[model samples]
Target: MSSTQQPQPVLNCDDLLELIPAYAFGLASPKEQQQVESGLTTCPEATAQLADYRRMQDDLRESVPQIEPPPALEDRLMAAIAAEPPARRRMPQVHRAWWAAAAAVVALVFSNVYWISRSSSAPPKAPDTNSHPILVQGDSSFVLTSSREIRWVRLPSAQKNTDATAVLMWNVESEIGLLYVRGFPPLSAGKTFQLWLTMGDAKLSAGTFQVDETGSGALLFNVTAPIDEYTWARITEEPEQGSSEPGEAVVVVGEL
Candidate 1:
């Protein structure tokens, strides 16, 4: 009997866009990177989007400060785990239900003991307060605070709007940032989306982007000046090549 072979799944433009960020960052698997490269040759829109993402990746590498983790961090963590009581390390071979109950109790006791010890020890050093707060959407509760050199902000979708989502991660000190967007509507021919960094009355162009059928796109740009200087970021509809100034058509707006 002859057996039929199953066809492999084909990635569309939207699928390729989703992988663009990873590809540009060299985080994509070899197969995925090859697929993105192949897609770029066939899709002009994907090609343009890849170019922008590559530029962003380059800027991110140059601008973001890299610091090695404390050498003793892992050793300390391992020592702490080793210091836990030997009784806690030994688990009785009981029935499944009894095992679950015992596990829960052990977890509670261990956590309480660990916290108590930590509280009695020397006070930990304070984190850097000058880190840039990444505000997602308009919600202040979801802010990401980093003690490291870079500060990342994940922006949420507009109120009552389920159509799109965006994330902006950057190191204000390094003057480098990356914006990844998904679920925005695809533009018509001869039209594209433009990103603007608003500073008081002045609005500077970050770069332009185009989404796939599923509304996914990304942009990487270097902030020549301090990010604090820019108060707002917004995406607007513009001509294919983009415009010097933002047009009246606003797609999405976010506070920096």
Candidate 2:
């Protein structure tokens, strides 16, 4: 069986609980987040089942919700794309079986709604279980989560060493907040990565990004106040005419 010794897919505990929502919304795709980080570095029961799905995603981001798209879902997706039937010119080879049967019924209904929305959260808790991630009100404080794993370094004080490790999980309740990032790094040729929020010296400028090569990147910052008065968070390496301070260093830091 040496076609690269085929016989791997046995990662269960239900495939590390289905790779924990792409490992807590960091959205695994850097080769499936390095094959779920090499199956959680040799599965200590899948690393305690992905730390109970990252503590039930920090207690469901303390009750996260702000779902939209129900303005009759854009009038029922523009009334079903204006009632189909438009590729006329009468059956030119039945137009690739009518667009491959409408792309196999939209990939079998989006893979059955991604396997029923992959276990809909709620699982990990018990490490002295304590949580407090609420702040849903009128939704729109700050939320941005993105990580599909991507890191390719060349170090030596990086004049260009590649990067990716995203994190900005914040949920400050009605005062509003939620930013999430995971394993993000990928930017070559005229680099860029800047995001910072401090309170002491009041250095606020939460924006700037670059990542692709499957190390997905995202942004959604809207703060009119209350991100717990920001207490340090960083990401710098700018200079496409950007920088009021923090020239470079601290590729990833915490505390916010």
lDDT of the candidates, in the order given? 0.59, 0.48
Model 2, residue 33: what's the lDDT? 58
Worst 10 residues of 2 by lDDT: 146-155
| Residue 65 Cα positional deviation in candidate 1, in Å, after optimal superposition | 51
lDDT of 2 by residue, 1-256 (tens): 4443333454555676677677767886555555565566556876786787788878988897867656778888879889984431222343335323322332232322111111326422211123321112222322211111111111111222345354444433323332333345555567676677787877776766554456544333445565566676677767655577777555665565
lDDT measured at residue 92 in model 1 versus the true structure, 0 to 100: 24
Off by over 4 Å in 2: 1-122, 126-169, 173-186, 189-192, 202-210, 213-226, 231-236, 239-245, 248-256
Candidate 2 lDDT score relative to the true structure:
0.48
Q: List candidate 1 stretches off by more than 4 Å.
A: 1-147, 156-162
Instruction: List TM-scores for all candidates, in order.
Output: 0.41, 0.21
- TM-score, candidate 1, is 0.41
Instruction: Output the lDDT of residue 10, model 1.
Output: 44
Error of 1 at 116 (Å): 41
Give one digit per residue, the lDDT tens place, for model 1 in 45-65: 777887898787788789978
